[model samples]
Structure formats: structure tokens, C-alpha cells
Target: MTDLRDVTLRDGLQLTGKPLPTARKVAVVRELLDAGVPSVEIGSMARPDLVPPLADTLDLIRALDPDELARCWVWVATPRHVERAAEAGAVNFQYCLSASDAHNRANIGRSTEDSLAAMPRAVAAASAAGGRIQLCIATSFTCPFEGAVPEERVLAIARDPRAEGARDIVLCDTLGQAVPTQVTSLVARVAAEMPPRRIVYHGHDTWGLGVANTLAALAAGASEVDGALGGLGGCPFAPGASGNASTEDLLFALRPSWLTPSSFARIVRLSGALLDELGEPNRSRAAQGARTSATAFPWALGAEVSCR
Candidate 1:
């Protein structure tokens, strides 16, 4: 089974009007964990002034139990970011950079080469903090500024000597612009050519192909994928990007062992409440479908069993 890392509390809150309180964020993390999501990205180390919703990432990190934190990820764009977050009790780090220099500069205030050069240091910081790190390549498919990032540009970063110690390599569809064919081809190439590391696909639904591309990547040997609870999120830096792939939709399609009708109901309920708090519409088709009056459907949240 492909491991689905739910990014609701982190990426899902990015574009929302109000950030959830630290207590609420902690509760959401536990709810997802209780529901058996194997992994989650709870927050990022982006400049709080720039990304206000992510301001309390450190507080959430400190509040979580170490065991709970182990299965969670926090985003970082530099060695210093990783170091600071590690000190704040974050255990797993996703060191992120963009494939294109222009996007990297726009997102993280640095060149692509500068970010690549910082990888080894970030890896060392995670290791020294007794945690693991993953290399997350944003704009792996396309750049908002540059447009249509080359496949080789991404492959080169994956193959970079500095990226060696990363346990996983995540290819991000930052702009949600990649088609299934593009996702499949790149994932296949990386799986075949790159050294053995867990291949992860992080996609967006801007073009409505998020689920399609995720399945394609999984078929091409991606071991993990990312999604968000209410399909909330978009890059402030990358225009035209929508939410990450919906966790509700992915669970419905993948049908993981943890997703019983009852557990699914709980997930939908929690996401509903959380989305309501954020004042963001639930963009998840599956979540909306479950709440519909189609109670005859086995997958409906309102239907545990059929009366007929």
C-alpha cells in the first residue's frame, strides 16, 4: 500500500483566512493519527510574516508527543530552518527547494544551486538531532515564474551528490500543472535510474488531474503520496496553483485498511469542522459526495449499512 501523508494542518491551511489555534492544530494532528494516517506534514518554517498561518509551527512541534512527532513532517528551505525546527522538537524534516532557480529565488529567497549546496548541512543537522530528512523538490513539474521546468532539471537534483543521505525524494507539482503522462514519465525515470530511495509524489489539483497523476506515479513506483484533508492550499508564490490532492478523495479511492465506514465518517466530520473553522470551502469531491443524500451508497458517510 502506498503511504499517504496527509498535509492538511500544514499545506491545507496556507490560503485560509484564519489559522487554527495551536491547541486545535494539535487536536487535528491527533485525530488524523487516531484515524491511522501513516504520515502527516503539520507545518512549515516559512517566514511567519509571509505565511501567517504557519507562524505557530514551532508551538505545535513542542506540544506534540515525541512518538506523535516521529510520524510527522515539517517543511524547511534551508539548513538554518532545519536546525531551528529540530531544536523546537520536530523530528522529521522535509528540506524543500524548487527545481528552477527563478522559482527557488521567489519561494525561498535563494538560487537553486544555493539550496542544493545547503542539503548536506541540512542532512547533517537532522542526523545530529537524531532524526531523518527527505529532499523535497518543489516545482519539479513546472515553475510559476519560469513555466514547464525540465525533467532533467529535477533528475539532476535527485542525482546530486549532496542529496545522497536523504531517505526519500519528493517530487512536487507545486503549480498543479503536470499531466498524468508527465508525472508517470518522471516517476518512472527516477525509480529506474536514481539510487534506491523512497519516491514520493506531491501533487496539486489545479488542472483536476491530481488523483489521476497520483495513481500514475504510484504505478510508476512511487512509494508515497501527499494529500490534504479539505483540499485547502496554494502557493502564495506560484499563481494558479490550487489545493493539494484531497486526502478525502485519496482515501476513498485507495481504500486503505484503516478506512472503515465508521472511521471515514469520523474523518469527514473532523475535516468538515476544521474547514468550517478556517472558513475555507471543502474542495474534496469525495467528502462532499459522502455528505450528499445518496445514502444508498455504501461509501456514504450517513450510511453504515443498507436497509434493503
Candidate 2:
């Protein structure tokens, strides 16, 4: 079975101009757990001025129920962030590195090599603090500033995370410019170096290839995928970037296999409600189309439509 990680609370809120209230974030976490999601990327411990939405990362982590807290993951941009997350009871930590130096400089105010050099220390600190690490190689396919990223460059940086005890390595299409063929080839190359089961695909829908690339990654042997509810995420520092692949759409695509039709529908409803509450537009095309269809022909149906 493929594992899905919901990143709605972290990456989803990273670029939103307004911050989500602590109560609403806690509510969303509970709803996601109830929907049967195995893992959730709860929040990030980045600079408060850089990513204002996550200023209350510690409080949010504290608000989670004991059981949910055990399953939550937080983003760590530095060793300090990892230490803070560990102190706040987060056991799973995600570290992101850009494949392109130019993009990395723009995003993190450092070169790609600098970020790679810092990983061992951060990973070691997290490990010492009893945290499981997941490393994300961002702009793995194409970089907004530098364009296409070479396969060798990605593989080289990926080695650092694996060497530093990262349990999972996620290949991210940070600018959403990847296609199926590229995803397949890159995933195949990485899978040759590491266990395919440890590979995760994190994609954006900017070019409308997020789902396609994810499917390609799975076909190429990746065992896990990441998505945000209602397609609500983007890298504010990555130019032309858009939301991550929508969880509702991905569940619909994986229907009858990893997700039941009823569960998929439930997630869709919950996502719509959550996005509405946040005063943000639901970026899921599948959800938007469904709402449009229902509105356009209000009297067409006699009973509830079953996804099954």
C-alpha cells in the first residue's frame, strides 16, 4: 500500500498572506486524522519573519492530542528548528534542500552546497533528539530560476540525506514543471541508488502535471506521495510556483485501491469546508468542477451521487 502524507498545515499555509488560527489548525489536524490519513506535516519551525503563518508552530504542536502528536511531522530548516521541534514533541522532521543553487539562494538565502553541508548536522541533531528525518530535494525536476536540473545534481545531493539517516527522501517538483517521462527517468535513477520504498513524490499543479507526475513516480516504484488538502500550497520563494497536488483529487484518482469511494468523498467535503473557513479559494480542479456542475444544473439530480 502507498502511504500518503498530508502537508496542508505546513506548506499549504506557507505562502498564504494570512495565518491560520491555532484552533482552526488543530481542527484541521483532527479532521485529517479522522479521514484515515496516516501522516500529516503539521507545521514548520522556520523564521517567524520569513514564514509568518507558522509563527505559532510550538503552540500548534502543543495543541495536538497526545495520539495525534505522535503522528505529526514538522519542517526543520536548521538545527535550531529541529531542536525546537523535538522539544515540542515532534518526532518526525522534514528537511528541504533545493537542487539548484540559484533557487536555493533565493529560497533559503544560501547556496545549494551550503544547504547540503548543513544537512548532516541538522539530521544528526534531530536523530540525537529521537526524531525521524525525511529529506525533501526541492526543484528536483526544474528550477524556476535555473531551469532544468540535471539528474546527477539531484542524485549527488540525495546521497547526503541518505547518509545522514533520513528515513524518507522526497523528490519535489518545486516549480511544477515536471512531466511523466522526466519523473519516471529521475525516479528510476534515484531508485537505483536507494530503496524505492523510501522514495516519496511531492508535486505541484502549476503546469497541471502534478497528478500525472505522482502516478508516474508510483509506476516508477515510489512507495509514498505528498499532497495538500484542497490543493492549498506553494513555495513563496519559488517563482511561478502553485499549490501542491490536491489530496481530494489524488484520493479520487486512487479510488478503490488505497482509498475507498466513501472516504474520498468525505475528504472532498472536509477540504471544501476547511478552505471555505480559511477564506481561501479551493484550488482543487476536481472540487471546483464538481461545485460548478452542481450549481449549473441545480435540479438535475434526485438523490446523492455516490462516488462508489
Candidate 3:
């Protein structure tokens, strides 16, 4: 079975244009963990002025138990973020950097080379603080302004990060432009150099291929897969970009083999409820179909119509 890691708090809040208060964040974190999500990316250490929702990340960490904090990972985009996370008692850190030149310049005010050069320092700092670090290689599939990232560029970045003491690396399809074949090929190639456990897949569903590409990654020997709870998040660069593959949707698609049907359906139900409360749309096909199915609520259908 592939390990699923929820990125709801980090990726979900990106470009949301709204701030999630501390109380709401705490509640959401508690709810996600209680749902048996296994792992949840709970927050980011990026600039608070930028990601205001996570302004209380330190407080959120303080409120969580050490054991609970161990299960919930957070992002650290720079050494400063790493220091802040360590102070907040986060155990696992995913240090992120954009691979696309345009994104690197715009998002972090640096070149891809500069970000790469700084990665070792970030990893070293996290290590010194006794935190596990994963270098997240963003925009592995496509870049909005650049478009069509070459395989060589991605492989080079992966090699450098791997050499920099990064225990794990994630290939992020930030723009959701990855095809199944490409996902399979890239994961397979990366796995050849590193252990399968060291590679993670972060795919988006922009073209309706998130779950398909995830299956491809697993087939290609990827051990970890990243997703969000209810298909939250959008690419700021790519217009109309959707969220990561919903955890519920991924489980549903992986069902009858990798996941039990009942277990998968339970998570889907919870995810649907969370989305409803957030006033967000349910983007899972299976979820929408189930909601509309006659068996969902016999009384509602009957109450609305008569067989006459």
C-alpha cells in the first residue's frame, strides 16, 4: 500500500485569498488527525505577512501534543522558517524551493541555482535541530511562464538535493501538467538512484489525471504520495489550476486492492463533510456520483418526486 500524506494546510491554503484563524486551524488539524490520515502537512513557515493564516503556527504547535506533533509535518521555505519550526517543536520539515526559474525569482527572490545552493544550509539547520527534512522540488512537471520542464533539469535538481543530505525528495507537479507516462518514467528513474522510500509524488488534478498519475508513481515504485483532504488549493501561476488529488479520491481509485472499500468510503464521507463546511465544491467524481445516487437518501428522492 502506498503511504498517503495530507497537504491540506500547506497546499490547501496557498492562494486561498483568506486567512484561517488559529481556532479553525487547530480544529482542522485535530479533525484530520482523528480521521486517521496517517500524516498531515499542517502548516508552513513562510513569511507570516505573506501566509497570514499560519501566523499562529507556533501556537498551533504549542497546543498539540508531542506525539501528535510528530505525526503532523510542516513546511520551511528558508533557514528562518526552519528555525521558527524548531522553536515551535515541529518534528518533520519539508523545505521547499521552486525549480522553475521564473517562480524562483518571483516567489523567493532568487535564482534556481541560488535556491539550490541554499538547500544544504536549510537541511543542515533542520538536522541540527533534530528534525527530518525533505527537499520539495516544486514545478517538476511544468512551469506557467516557462512551460515543459525537461527531464534533465529535473534530474539534475534531484541529484543536487539528494547529495545535500536530503533524506527524501518530492517531485511536485505544481501546475498539474504531468501525464501518466511521464510520472511513471520520472519516478522509475529517480527510484533507480535512491530507495523507493526516499521518493514522494505530489500531483495535481488540473487535467483530471492526478489519481492516474499517482497510480503510475506507485507502479514506478514511489512509496509516498502527497494529497489534500478535499481537493483544495490552486496554482497561482497556472490559471484555473485545481487542488492536489483528493485523499478520498485517491483512496477510492486505489480501492478493492490497495485500500478496503469501506475504509476508503469512510474517508470520502468525512472529506465531503469538511468541504461542505468550508463552502467548497466536492471535486471527486465518486463523491458527486454517490451524493446523487438514489441509495444516498431514499427519503429525499421520494420526498421530491412521486411514482404516480
Candidate 4:
């Protein structure tokens, strides 16, 4: 079965200039869980100055109902962040490294080599702290500053994490420039080395191929995919990058047998509410089309929305 992890609260809200109240973040997460989303990246343990919206990451996690929190997976950037989150009861942690040196430097003020060297430490820390870890290879396809990244470069980085006991590795289309062909080719090559279930695809929708590329990856044997609700996420540090594949849109495209029509509608309504709350234009094509075709979206009609 294809597993979808909603990243709206963590990656989605990071770049938005406005900060979402902790209550709203908790409410959205609860809605997503109720809608049958298996995993949710509720917040990141990053510095407040770097991303103001996630400043209250710990508080947000604390506010979640224990039952819901038990069902959630959280993301963090470094071993230090992982340690903190694990102490606060986070069972899962995600750390990222860019395949392109230039993008790495621009993103974390560090070189790709330095980041790769630190993987073992990060994984070790997370594991020792009783947290399951997933490693993300950012700019796995193309980089905004460095252009196209070689598949070998990404594969080599993947080796480090895998060796450090990271069974799940997410290949990120940091700039959203990857085509389906590239996704299938690279994922196939990676699956040849690792188990197919160990691979995940994280895509953005800048070129409108997010879902297409994701489908290609799944066809190529990726076991999981990552998306944001309302398509609300972009890398503030990665220039030219856009929001991720919309959760509602992906569900609409895949029409998974497990998701009922009522559940689908509830997810779409929650996505619409999130779009309205962010005061941002609907980045989700599915949401926009639904609003246009039906008069049911009172929030979309009542408000003037602008894109980020």
C-alpha cells in the first residue's frame, strides 16, 4: 500500500510569513488524522529565527491529544533537534541533506561532504533516543543554484544514511524541476541497491508534474510519498521552488480504495479551511476546480486570496 505523509504543519507553514496559531495547527492535524491520513509531520525543531511559524513546535506537539500524538510522526533538521524532539515524546524524526553542494551551502551554510559525514551521528543519536529516523536527500533531482544533479551524487549520499540504519530515504525534488522519466529512472536505480519499500518520493508542484512524477516513482517501486495539505509548502531557502503536491489532489488522482467519498470531501474541506486561514490563494488545483464548479466553498467565495 502507498503511504502518504501530510507535511502541511511542518514544511507547509514554514515559508508563510504569517504564523498559524498553535490551536489552528492542532486542529488541522486532528482533522487530517480523522480523515484517515496515516502520518502527519506536525512541526520541526528548528530555530525560531530561521522559521518563525514552527517556533512553537514543542508546544504544538504537547497540545495534541495523546492518542493523536501517538499516531503522529514529527520532523527535525539535526541530531540536536532529534534529541530534543525525542525527549518531548516524538517517536519519529526526519533529517535532510542536499545532494548538490551549492544547494547545501545555500540551505544550511555547510558543504555536502560535511552534511554526509554527519549522517551517522544524526542517525545514531535518533536511534539511541528511541526514535525511528528517515533521511531526506534534498535536491535529489535538480538544484536551483547548481542545476541538474547527477543521480550518482544522490545515490552516494543515500549510501551514508542506509549504512547508518536509515531504512527510509526520501528523494526530494527541491526545485520541482524533475520530470517523470527522471523520477522513474533514479528510483529504479536506487531500488536496485535497496529494498523498494525503503524508498519515498517527496515532490513539489512548480512545473505541474508533482503528482505525475510521484506516480512515476510509485510505478518504479517507491513505497511511500510525501505531500502537504492545500499544496501549502515551499522552501524559503531554495529559490524557484514551489508548494508540494496537494494531499487532496493526490487522493483525487490515486482514488485509493481505502478512502471513502465522505472522507475525501472532509479532507478537501479541511484543505480549503487551511487555505482560507493562511490568507493565501489556493495552490491546490483540485481545490480551485471544486470551488469553481460548485458553490459549496463559502470560504473561497467570501475572501480575497493571494498567492505567496
Candidate 5:
């Protein structure tokens, strides 16, 4: 019953071998919206020189219509990033920063405190553009350079006065090292103690606990969760990080009200085609299981779904 924000285009394609064309990205977004996904992280405002694959984010933004843009999120770091993306018609901005100083510096080129200090301006920019903003805390669980991030560090960012106007707060396991217990504790604390904004869980599958941690976060009060098709994503800045939680797997497990059997089949086929086009392996067990010959299983894809 929870909302799944598919990050297939933004995070999923980050580590891919080739960049997807703007027309293809537009088609995928339309298909995803048609298939019932509530939100999609379509792209980022990060420097093109740093991540060449996502360099076309602004073009993709221009391709989507306003209604489509409303359901899509564009990742940003500073106020100017938000402003630029807003000019490109991005309505939802996910202003991101890591919980640790090292990872924050590595990922966004600034300290965690500096990122927090800029949130008020980022929020204002989103408001000025007549859109909404979400505060996204990366490295919420562990940082590649500094190791474990204390729970208090994440809480402080969430409770910061400058982060006032964000509509939601996303806690990210950038390195995928957080177990279910860690996810549960932090998510519960944020829900019970922090500002009354919605909690979002963004996890990676580095240690094979992405789904478990996601379930834990949901149980702890995360109404929305992020995942990528075929589990394709890794922080370019965070060494040792791997793919994201699988969107196909989450759809099967969560079974939100809008998701029908046909819709699930469509999502599976779409993910399969995209992964095949990129020549990437499918890391989603649920996605693999869905393609089984056993048609009797309710979760199994019927003969109609095939990317090959």
C-alpha cells in the first residue's frame, strides 16, 4: 500500500554503460506513469562533467510535459541547482546532502553543515518556482570514507530549522551497509521525534539487505520508498556502493492498490527491456522469479510479458 518512487532513470542509469537518449527516457517515464508508479526520480542537477550519463537531465526535463513533471523529481544539491532544474520545468526537487562530512564533501563538494545551511535557500527556490522540495540525507547509515554515521547526525539534519519547508525527508543508505535494525531505529526515531514530514527510505543492495531494510523502514513509518529497475544504481562518489533496491521486487512485495497483475507484468517487461538495452544483468530475484515457467503462481508473469 506504500508509494514506490522508481529511480530507474536517475539512479539506475547512473552506473550504466551508455546514456539513454532523451526520447527513450521520455517514453519510459510515460510508460512508468501509465503503469501506476506514483513518483519517479527522473534525473539530477549534478555537474555533467562529473557524471556524463546524466548530463542530459536538463534535456529530459524539457521533454516531459508539466503534468508529467509534477510526478517526477529532480535531484539537486544547492539553491542554484534547484533554480536551474526549476527553469527546466522540474516541479519536485530532492535536495540532497550526506550525513557525514567526508561523504558530503565527496558527493556535494561541501560539509554536511554547509549543505544544511543552504536548505532554506533551496526550499525558497523551490517555492519561488511554485514547486515542492524534499530534504534527502545521503549516507544516513554509513559513509564510504568515514565509516559509520552516528544516528544523531541524521536526526540533527532532519531537525534543523533551515530544513523547515521540505515536504518530505529521505534517509539514504548510500553504501547499502545498514541492516534492518539500523533502518528501523532511525526511521522510527525520525517519524516519532522529527518534524511531521513524510519519511522516505532510499537503500542500496550492497550487503543484500536492501529489501529487508526497506520493509523495516516502511514498518517504522516510511510511506514512500525508492528503488531502481533491475537494481541498477551506485553512488559515483561513494566507493564500494552498489545498485539500489529493485523496483520490480518492491512492486511484487508491496502490492500497492494501484498495481494490478497486468501492470506488474508491464513493469517487469519494461525493466527487462531497459536492462537488456544497457547490457546489464538483472539483480532482482523477484524479477527473475516473475519470468518463471510456472504460470500458476500469482506473482509469475504470464506468457504476455517478454523483453526478449
Candidate 6:
């Protein structure tokens, strides 16, 4: 089965300027797990001062009952963040570092080289703390300031982290500039460089090719994928970009290949309900279908899964 990780809490809300309340966040997590998502990227470790929207991140973590998502896994970033997450009972961790020089400076106030230099130390810290590390190579695709990132640069980043004992590595399509051919080719290259099980695709939907790129990566042998709940994320640091691939849309599109329609549709309904409660309009294809026709309420079963 394909592994799916939802990123609505972390990436989804970064641009909305509204922090989801702890209760609402917890409810969404429970709903996602019930919908059968194996994992969720709930928040980030960036300074709460910089992202007041996620200021309650630590508090949310502190109050999270392990049993609420017993079947699901949640992840966060940074060594200090991981420590705090551990205190709050998070079972998984995602350590993000930028690969694009321009984005690194803009997002983390560090250069690519500086970020790479810190990887070994970050990896060591997380490992020492006894949590699994999923290193996120952000801006693996084209960058806004510096377009068309070289494949070799991304490969080097992935290889270095893997060499440092990172068990999981995600290639982030930060600006959603990646095409299917690029995604497939990159996945093949990364797979050849590292263990196949360790690679994942984290795509954005800016150009409306999120699902297409995801299929390309999967077709090229990627076992895991990352997306948000309802097409709900945009880079707060990266200017004029769009959201991550919607969890509901991604699942609905991938149903035939990965999950049964009944399973995918259930996830859509739960995700839609949470989105409604959050005061955000649904951007999911399944949700749109439901609005248009009751027959499409369970759209995943018959919806076209073709890559655009």
C-alpha cells in the first residue's frame, strides 16, 4: 500500500494567518486517522515568535493524548522542536533543511551550505533522542528566485542525509514548479542513490499538477507521498505560491492505484467536515462533486484517476 502523510496542520495553515485552535487541530487529527491516513505533519519547529499562528504548537503538543491518534503517526521539525514534541508524546519526527540557496536564505536565514553543514548535527540530535528522522529537502524543484534547480544539487543533499543515517528523505516541490517528467526522473535517480523505502514525494499544487507529479513519482517507485487536508497550504516564506496537494484530492485521485474507493471516500468526508468547521471552504474535487450532485458524494469510486 502507498503511504500517505497529511500536512494540513503544518503547511496548510501557515499562510492563512489563523492558527487552528488546539481542540480543532486535535479533532482534525482524529478525523484523519479515522479516514485511514497513516501519518500527519502537524506543525513546525520554527521560532513561535516568527510564526505566531503556530505559537500554540507546543501547547497543542502538550495536551495531545496519545490515544487520540493511536493508529496514526504525527511529525514535527528541529532538535528542540523534537524534544518538545517528545514531551508532548509525538511518535515521529521530520527534520527539514533547505536545498535551494535562495530559499534557504529567505526561509531559515542561512545559506544552502550552512544548512547542509547543520544536517549531521540535527540528525545526531534526533537520533540521540530516539526518534525517527525524516529529512525534508525543501525546494527540490524549481525555486522562485533561482529557477530550475540542478538535479545534481538535490541528489547530493539526499545522498548526504542518507549517508548520515537518515532513514527517510522527502523531496519537496516547494513552489509546485515540477512537471511529471521531472518528478519521475528525480525519483528514479534518488531511488538508485538510496534505499527505495526511504524516498517520498512532497508536492505543491500551484500549477495544478500536484496529483500528476505525485503519480509520476509513485510510478517511478516512490512509496510515500505528502499532502494537506483540503488543498490548504502555502509557503509563508515563499512569496506568491500555492498550497500543497489536497489530502482528499490526492487520495481521491490515487484510490484506484493505492486504496479502495470506500476507503478514500471516507477520508474525504471526514476531511471535508473538519474543513467546514475551520471556516475554510473546501477545495477538494470530491467535496466539489458532492456540492454539485449527491451521486458524487462517493466520487472516488468512479472518479477518473488519470494524470493531467
Count steric clashes of candidate 3: 0
What is the Cα-based TM-score of model 2? 0.90
Relative to the true structure, how large is the alpha-carbon lDDT of every model? 0.89, 0.81, 0.75, 0.80, 0.91, 0.74
Could you tell which candidate, 1 or 2, scores higher by TM-score? 1
Number of the candidate with higher TM-score, 2 or 6: 2
Which lDDT tens digits does candidate 3 get at residues 1-308?
56788887778767565566777777777776665667788887766786675667788877788888888888877777777788878878888777788876766667888877877778877888887888788888788778888877888888874336788888888878899999998888888877633888999988889899988998998888888877787655455567888777775555423344344555667667667666777777666655667376343223353321
**Displacement of the residue 233 alpha carbon in candidate 5, Å:** 0.6
What residue pairs are clashing in model 4?
A: none
TM-scores for all candidates: the values are 0.95, 0.90, 0.87, 0.91, 0.96, 0.88
Question: Of the pair 3 and 4, which is ahead by TM-score?
Answer: 4
Candidate 5 clashes between residue pairs 3 or more apart in a chain or in different chains: none
Candidate 2 per-residue C-alpha lDDT over 19-63 given as tens digits, one digit per residue, 9 for 90 to 100: 688988898888888878888998888778888988888999888
**TM-score for candidate 5:** 0.96
lDDT rank order: 5, 1, 2, 4, 3, 6
Residue 244 CA error for candidate 4 (Å)?
0.6
For residues 1-308, write the lDDT of model 5, one tens digit per residue: 58999998988888887878889999999999999999999999999988877899999999999999989999999999999999989989999998999998998899889999999999999999999999999999999999999999999989989998999999999999999999999999999986479999999999999899999999999999999998999989999999999998888778777877789888889998989988899998887887874474453433354311
Clashing pairs in model 1?
Answer: none
Largest lDDT belongs to which candidate? 5
Write model 1 residue lDDT over 1-308, tens digit each, in one string: 77999998777888777868999999999999998889899999999998999999999999999999999999998888889999999989999999989989988999999999999999999999999999999999998889888899999999999999899999999888899999999999999987579999998999898899998999999999999987888888887888999999988877776667777777888988988888888999988888884564464533353321
* Model 6 residue pairs with clashes: none
Task: State candidate 6's TM-score.
Answer: 0.88
